[model samples]
Target: MTAEATTRAAELKQAQAALQQGRFAEGLAMARALVQDDPGDGEALYLAAVAARYLKDYEAAEDWLSKLHRAMPEYGRAWQEAGHLALARGREAEALAAFVRATRFNPALEASWREQARLLAAAGRAAEAAMARRQQERLARLPRELVAVTNHLAEGRLLRAEEICRHYLRTHPRKDANHIEGMRLLAKVGIEFGVLEEAEFLLESAVAFAPDDVQLRLDYIDALRRRQNFAKAHEEAEKLYARDPASPVFRSRLAIESMAVGDYERGLELFDAVLQQHPRDPANLTSKGHALKTTGAREAAIAAYRAAIAAKPDHGDAWYALANLKTYRFGEDELAAMKEQAARPDLSFMDRVHIAFALGKAHEDREEYAASFAAYDEGNALKRAQTRYSADAMSAELARQKAVCTRDLFEARAGSGHDAPDPIFILGLPRAGSTLLEQILASHSQIDGTLELPDILALAHRLRGRRVGENRYPDVLRELTADQLAKFGRDFIENTRIHRAGAPFFIDKMPNNFRHIGLIHLILPNAKIIDARRDPMDCCFSGFKQLFAEGQEFTYGLREMGRYYADYVALMDHWDEVLPGKVLRVRHEDVLDDLEGQTRRMLDHVGLPFEEACLDFHRTSRAVRTASSEQVRQPLNRKGQGAWKPFEPWLGELKEALGDLAPREI
Candidate 1:
């Protein structure tokens, strides 16, 4: 740590100690100083808030908590402290609501659960009180370290959560009961940290160790699905569904996993069954709309989305799903409903975010540019606050790849990997038309279109040796033996086979794989890699407007997204220089201008004979799982072209970040 940071850490420790010892004045002074130095420090703000609450300075406590909550919206302790402050002023209803929010954010908060149970019982809500007490008992049964880990995870401190979880597991390895929960918690951290392979292995082992544990099995299924083992995930889901076909949770899991494995009919049927059980269930209705939307059931998808909105007007996901359809136009009632949801103080964070982005699209469709940008910015700001993305760190990481994956490294490792010629990698920035290319290529008889396969990303993560000082990923590529590299390549092929059928070659359209192109070449030298490029303005702005399911944190801000694009371009240029004739750069606009020519070129690059079906890509029926799924299903058009023009005045940050790479008009 820096000298200043070390001193600040010491001060924080002293303040915390004082607070624990009932020295509220001293602790408050120290915390206030720290907050003055760094107003965004959540811990400092939390300490200040707590001290103020203890001192009965309710107004000051509220101010500190407002700052803390804004800086760390999902921090359960902050909300717990808020609840305590409300109770100090005899606001039982407010305290109850705060405690409820606290538990929602972090179920490990036993105090929140206890308070909720007490408040609910006082309110004569017997069932809610019982539920809250049950939750409190559940937390009491678990290890304290797991509770801390869960709180850390809830507040987005993923690295700290992993460290505590690992230490706890190592200290109590043979305690099967504790071990299983620890492993599950570690797996959750792994998932949040994008270490999918570790997460899958951990969850799978936990499941094997406790097959009767329903939660473990559910977590295992989630990890498997994230790792793109759709069939295996579906198998696990099927087991759960068989165990209890009437369970809404199992039924929903089966429905979603069925969609993953390309059984859209079955997924829709299961969704219908769930709806039958609870017809006004907003989440299920929204999920059904998603399954319908992805499978090209346009009218059905629209109806499902509207039904969800009708059932629960504040359910923002259903509203966002309609907006995500890209071609769906919002009616006045729908627009007003979304605006109402967005304005609701009680709306959940994600629901508010979903409503904001949905409103952004709604206004954009109506050509209300300023309102559109404002809503989009609001949603992006919320997501940005929740994430811990660093553009500088990303730049440094990309630089390491360019530095370590040199021509000499390739020359020395020549012929050192498995000779896999059956894989085609479509990689680049997310909104850069990779889905379109995959659709066109998968249209060929020999090529299979798959979900954004996670195998390559998992390999890259494995290459990142440990979590110490600096990451040793592309650099570690130099230390890996030929056998190890070959095995990695072989394992990737075998693991990903579940996503493919009889096709000789399949596309792994994981856009972030662009960051690990060198790793790809080192492991599978003969695999075809396509660099899918798009117009910077359209790509960056589209990414900015998007609320990704997860990851791609850079897209939550215009400047960061633009900077990432520039870094990506520079890294790809390095790859071209070092690995000449190895990557084929395909521009989205060029493809639009000459579809048949580009199609033939891509086929030729993969050594496939040109087929008419490649040109008739939009006609090919397949389940696309990306945001651009709907767009790629229709015939070619410039629907996305110049989309940023309407918001050009508000895009100075993006233009400045893009530097000379941005369009002259921008």
Candidate 2:
């Protein structure tokens, strides 16, 4: 480190020590000096606020906290301090709101949850108070080290959290309480790091060690779901439900899992039972709306969303869910109500984000392109700030794949994997018509349609190990034995069997799988690969405007989306060169112009017979789980062909990123 940086760090530590020692005056002086050196030093500002609050200098505390809030709106500690300030001033409502905000930003804050519970009880809101108490109790049960891990994880310090978790695991006895806690914490870090396989293994081991631990089992189920091992997730969910058949929470979880695995009728029935027991539950109503929407029951889904709104007018998710249908139009009153909620200072950050996206969709439906773009931009900005995604890092990763996955590497590993050939990978950038293609293929009698399964991505992440600074994936492929590759291939098929019906082939339409084609080829050499292509402008713009439920963090910015699309194209071209004629490229526009011909081509590529049902894919009765769920449920149209024209004025970043790849016309 530089001399100045070392000195600054030492000084900050000294200031923190003074505060911990209750030397308020000395701590305040040090904090002020630090702030003077760098006004935007968030730690210094936070320390100053804490010291001033301890010294009973209310005005000074308020000033420091205001600066901290301005610099870091999502900083939960600042909001917690603000709550304390309000409480000291006897503003119970303001204190409650601040505490709620603090917990929303960082749920690991046990103090905030306790304070919220107390305030809710005082306000006579018994149900909410009980919920808050439960949350606080959950945190309180964790060991100090795990609590620290949770705090670090909440603050986006995954490496620090993992370090603490690993230390605890190494020091604690196996199968003991502390060790189980450590395992859970480490598994959480894995999930956050996108290493789902490791998380699944850890949670499964933890659950086996403590078979009766309900929370451990629940965590296992979640990990299974994240890895897209739907069968196991469903099995675990059923066990949880069987343990407490009358528990609405358990029933709700099982219902969601059922919907995930395409048991729509059973899911709807379970949701109905939950609604019967708790008629005013907005979350359950919203979930029911999702099940209905995915099953192509648009009107029923709309009614469910409206019911959720009626149960709780400020339910931002319901509003956003309706907007996400891509065809639902908000009424004037609904739009005004959404705007009011969006403008509320006390609204949760996620709620405000949902309202912003909903308003964006509302404006777009009315052809108010400027308003739509502004709202969409605001929503994307908020979501982007919370994500740890780096476009440059992603580009570097893709570049590494190209460098390592040479023809020689593939030729060396040729014919070494499982020979099942039951998987068809429709891979490309999101919003690039993969879902449309999947819908068509799924319409065929021999192919089963599934959600974007994470098996390939999870395997890739597992191979990278748990270290923070490592790129051990495509390079590690060189070290794998033929038997290991075959095992991985077999594991992928066996794990994904939960999402399959009795079809001979199933489609794995994860768009990000484009970056892992070499790994796919190495493990599942006989797999059918289809490249879903689209107009760059239309595809990137569509992705930017869509708020995906999870992943696809690259879509939050126009430049990131464009650059990712370009990277995808370059990698796919490399694959074409190295594995010639192995992957069939399906342009979305070609499908729009000639659905029958492209349908036949895709079926022929997969060695399936031509079927009239493939052309009538929209008429199929399967669950579609994507942003384009509504759009894909209808027949092909020219509606989205040039959808980016209206927002052309603000697309300079995307256009510049695309360069020669940019569409000829705006």
Candidate 2 colliding pairs = none
lDDT scores for all predictions? 0.90, 0.90
TM-score of each candidate structure, all chains considered together: 0.88, 0.90
lDDT of 1 by residue, 552-591 (tens): 9999999999999999999999999999999999999999
Candidate 2, poorest ten consecutive residues by summed lDDT: 343-352
Candidate 1, residue 311: the lDDT equals: 94
For residue 243, give model 1's deviation from the true position in Å. Answer: 2.4
| Lowest lDDT 10-residue stretch of candidate 1 | 462-471
Residue pairs with colliding backbones in model 1 are none
**Residue 304's lDDT in candidate 2:** 96
Q: What's the lDDT of the predicted structure labeled candidate 2?
A: 0.90
Expressed as tens digits, the lDDT of each residue in 1-666 for candidate 2 is 799999999999999999999999999999999999999888899999999989999999989988887667678888999999888878999999999989888888999999999999998999999999999998898788888997898778898999998988888789565788789889999898877777988999988888898888888999988877787899999999999999998999999999887888899999999999999899999999999999889999999999998998878899999999988899999989998887665465677778889999999999999999999999999899889889999999999998999999999988799998899999888888999999999999999998898889888887887665665887898999999999999999988888889899999999988889999999999999999999999999989988888899999988888888888888899999999998999999999989999999999999989999998988988888888999988988888889999999999999988887997763
Name model 2 segments beyond 4 Å from true.
Answer: 1-74, 93-110, 113-143, 311-314, 466-468
